[model samples]
Target: MLNKKIVEKKLTSKTYTPKVLKELYKIFNLRTKQEKQKLRKILLELISEGKIYKDSKGKYRPLKDNLAIGTLELTRNGTLAFVWTESGDEIAIPAEKLGNALHKDKVLVEIIGKWYDLPEGKVIKVIERGLKKIVGTFQPRGRFAFIIPDDPKIQYDFYVPVEYFNNAKPGVKVVAEIVKYPSPTRNPVAKVIEVLGYSDDPSTDFPTIVVKHDLPVEFPEKVLKEVAKIPEKVTPKDLKGRRDFRNEIIVTIDGADAKDFDDAVNVKKLQNGNYLLGVHIADVSYYVKEGTELDKEAFKRGTSVYLVDRVIPMLPFKLSHGICSLVQGEDRLVMSLLMELNKEGEVVDFEVTPGVIRSYRRLIYDDVNALFSGDKEAYRKIGDLKEQLFLMKELKDILRNARRKRGAILDIEGGEVKIILDEKGHTIDIIPRYRGEAEVIIEEFMIKANETIAEIFNNFDLPFVYRVHEQPDPDTILQLKNYLSALGINFKLPKKIQPKLLQELLEKTEGHPLRSSIERLLVRSMKRAVYSSTNIGHFGLASYAYTHFTSPIRRYPDLVVHRLIRNFLKTNGKLTKKKIKELNKKLTKIAVHSSKRERTADEAEWDYTALKKIDYISRHIGDVFDVVVTSVTKFGLFVEIIDKYISGLIHVSTMNDYYIYNEEKSILIGERKGKIYKIGDKLKAKVIKADKTRMQIDFEIYNEEENKSNIN
Candidate 1:
């Protein structure tokens, strides 16, 4: 018999070196073909056990040098996970290869294989558990219970002992503290620690999401007390060294729901026919000092989470919406930026300083847009300020043209939606969000301010938090090109993708029926924007330097930026080498933490919005709506309603008749009737099911069927 133990001992020896399979066979003296085959199988088993790794040269070696530690980030469906190493390499780990590692668990992975030339790995050991508690619904069965997690990335239902229920009733949302992690043969064990509320109640939505993402809803006692000590209004002492722009026609333009105004702007046409744009942002750092309890809490939250029905401010409401808010007719301290531009909208010179600004007017986006569109009431409301408004619009157009000329991406909308809820917390309407001229003006001005601030710090060689978006992966772009080609839209794959390349593609499909679909696909091909200590530039904005500096009231990075700017101004841009070194190290940690928090906030908001959308759909079960097939798969077709952009799955099993999925053609043909379903195909689908617990909405094609619900 071939001794597998001997093979293991050989690899674990003090001086054993990596060897090829043939060399290992010779060393083991396996002359018989069957013995050699057995040796190969043993080696494979050893590799699977994380005892060895196959190098690029096809030689087997120990896993020590090939090991990388990172958080095991599981996909939503839990079929796979990825570990992004410190070296910027993402290693794909199949579900079976995870070795019982849960989502977000810090684990050591050994690179063992390759998937399409990308590094693939297996978790060898769990270094640390990243998730402390899980939010889920408690379900009791006789003596034991299970908590089904709200997060889709969590694959296993936690097993809870009867005594550990913590008085949580069945079907209530609860927070479960992880008692023991899951092993290969056992499920995770947890104890119910906190009961949120009834799982199915409409009011429970906010708390559920808050617990699910572990977001803070209330300020700590000390932090609250600290905030109470702050002044209710800006004082003369606070504005002593700051330039005052209270009398300027500075105005804040935002949505009607906006309570906290962070930025206000004023514009002027100078003697040289150049435009002077002044952007004043609320000075949040002036109050939220570093190393304080309030500051610590803000750092932990990283960013404010804006959801369907709530705003989880980074700072308390006192600072976010009161003392720091630049409301109309109130004096507010700010860190201001003044940019001088000629007809071409190029920044000829700029000034960054601390200032005091009183917003002369609070303008809503709709009203401003209506005024620019020649609405008589909107125009009449602004009186003699009409000249300044015209100048502002002109400056906006000039800035927009400059961006386009510099190859900046002009159009890529996020498909945002505004969900209106009734008094009973039921979704009454879902209005698709659109950007008008006023919104665009604010966006352009913010981008310009962010760029200028980043450039200032970069020139001073200071460490700062930057908003970065890397270029899209070449493989993703190639895939997009293939998809477009299949749609008969001939797009040439470029060797180096400039910002204008994607814009051109979007323009080419301007009036096509699949324009939105193509835009979405193109957007996905691009990289996600993130906070980073290192500057890589923002590919989406086509900016060489960019950072968020206007929303200090809501974003922690902006607060940090504000502090840094204050320090620069106070010391005349001079800092000790030690301070710079300390900042460089600290900012890296801040960047990583802020990026993660931002992603969590974004996901939580999406989940809440989707839940409401699903809530609305469930009430109108059996109602048919026009849908366009967004994606075609072997299992089903994913479709989206045109107007509201609500998506649902048309499971293949619901098709009454079995359909043969044609992968190459990206279509499904009915076996009995030859009915075809393909991407971009317009069809009417009846809403069959909407399950909130599972976060699923399902539809079935409405044809000459006996009844609508029969397919369900």
Candidate 2:
């Protein structure tokens, strides 16, 4: 009874709470504090028994307060903020009080404030740390070294002792891990795990980024060995219990550089004048079963990442590029969804079957577009498949109409800066790539397949991972409307706003100076697409049901769908209640992971592209061009150069003439001269300077009347 009271007193006391004592015990085990304090600081986080708390001044007070658990999101300034799971409220902790907290650490954060605005916290216990490896450039600093993180979000440079360098030098990029980060230390101590080579090494840098982000570079040795042991040729076992479609003249339509094909199409005009369209997806589940090493690896990867120059696939190359890839002239396993559609594009009849089929040809987008447009050269190349090609075009248009009518967000084909590389993988030129009708046709076909499969699960009353996008919040929409109105654009607010209204606004803004900017705003207003087990429907597709079921080769959710469909189809035709519940939970977790990975990949890709574009423009410094006013603020007018397509600021003081900014109109009006510079107006400008490192371009308006005589 005395011991219990002592323990209770310790838990509620101001110093060394029960949680902290447990953590201290774990760190020390059976030793004293003097002995444990000498060890590295990072290893201290391994003692996850403590709670985090907040002091009076919005600062962390570790060991002094009870731990409150929350997920940590660290800022570049080294401050920690986390959302409390119980209240859905966020609190900030200053860097000084954070102790050894790292970004993405889940810790017990003790709340201190009654109000939301000034809430403070201290981390009581660290539930988890982001165990993901980090990539950075290492620099030797006398006796110790520090690594400048590649990810700008990672606020702190890791402190490394000279002994831990493993012979790595300054200016070299490397992968490393935090060894210790004690409360008293200014920087986290780390050890170089791998030297990835110099910054100029493109291949190594790209792959290192891939690895550092926890993206799989290659298949696991065991998985690769397993794939190799599988028979190369189609056998009787592979053909057993499958529908045969060997005689069908099916073909795959993909990008010119596409290697792994997951979908093939066959559309024919039936006797009733309705179309019979076959959407055959490669049955990867047949080879990669659940609970296997391959399945585990695929689940971990979540989805394939496609960068400008390369692809980081979820599965091993042998399976993703070989066995499961829908290559031409090869019999492959498939989960077939054959639908009979009338001229109105309504499904008349449908059949789902496990099947085996052979692809007749691999048709690239350019050749297909030429063939569809009656190009004789394309016909001369593949004259025999004319009838099938015509059917595909018609079917694709029907599906497109169905999608657009259902209120799918339609985006204009944006310019893609393709980084053309030479033999040594050095950037040669960055050319813009346009999307053609062929690409749209493939997209329409894939959407149809995805929707059809989603409907199949809905009919079976099975829980599945859905690709969902919720409607924009009313506040966000109102804000967007106000932004548009301020830009001198009349975007009328609907009584009840719909996706169609936003789409119409985008359409109206086409060819305007603010087209891309406005489109980006609208996209930003909309909720990010995410994976969810809950059947809320897809707001983007305007569908009552939606799931990613067509891209199993690249996406793990699709694989789950494949497994679920096959399990139910091949078994007694009903999923057990328990199994369904378990799948729901599992898929929900997968949805979160897949969504996170998608966002991470997007950020990385955007960073890389933006860097390259800025670097390219830096070459032609001080060049003038026509500029468009994107935004007019009280301080300055944000302008985008026409030829370079880069943004820069023109400060108010640099306007030369006395001007007053019209806040409501989002325009700048010269008071004395009465000259107006608005959001969409074109202006002549001279490139004053370019800062490549900061990605800033300085411009001075041409001031035609005043500066014309002196400039030339």
Q: Which lDDT values do the candidates have, in the order given?
A: 0.86, 0.72
Instruction: Please count the clashing residue pairs in each candidate, in the order shown.
Output: 0, 20
Q: What's each prediction's TM-score?
A: 0.86, 0.81
Give the alpha carbon lDDT tens digit for every residue of 1-712 in model 1: 5676888888878799999888998889889889998988998777644466666577877657678766778999899898865334578999999987898887778889886757899987775687889888899988999999989899999999998999988888888899999987899999998888774567778877877787888899999999999999998899888998887889999999998999999899899999999999998999999999999999999999998777999999989899899999999999999999889988899999889988999999988888888889998887556788778888899999999888888887666789999887888888888899889888888998999999998887789999999999999998788778757788777799988888888778876666677888988899889888889999988998899999999998999999888888888888889988888878877887787788888898889998899888888799999988888899999998776878999999888788899877778899998888877888889999987777889999877456645666
Query: What is the C-alpha local distance difference test score of candidate 1?
Result: 0.86
TM-score of 1: 0.86
Query: For model 1, what is the error of residue 18's alpha carbon versus the real structure, in angstroms, after optimal superposition?
Result: 26
With a 3 Å backbone cut-off (N, CA, C), the pairs that clash in candidate 1 are none
For model 1, the superposed segments whose C-alpha errors exceed 4 Å read 1-70, 84-92, 108-127, 165-173, 193-199, 704-712
- Predictions: Cα RMSD each: 10.8, 7.0
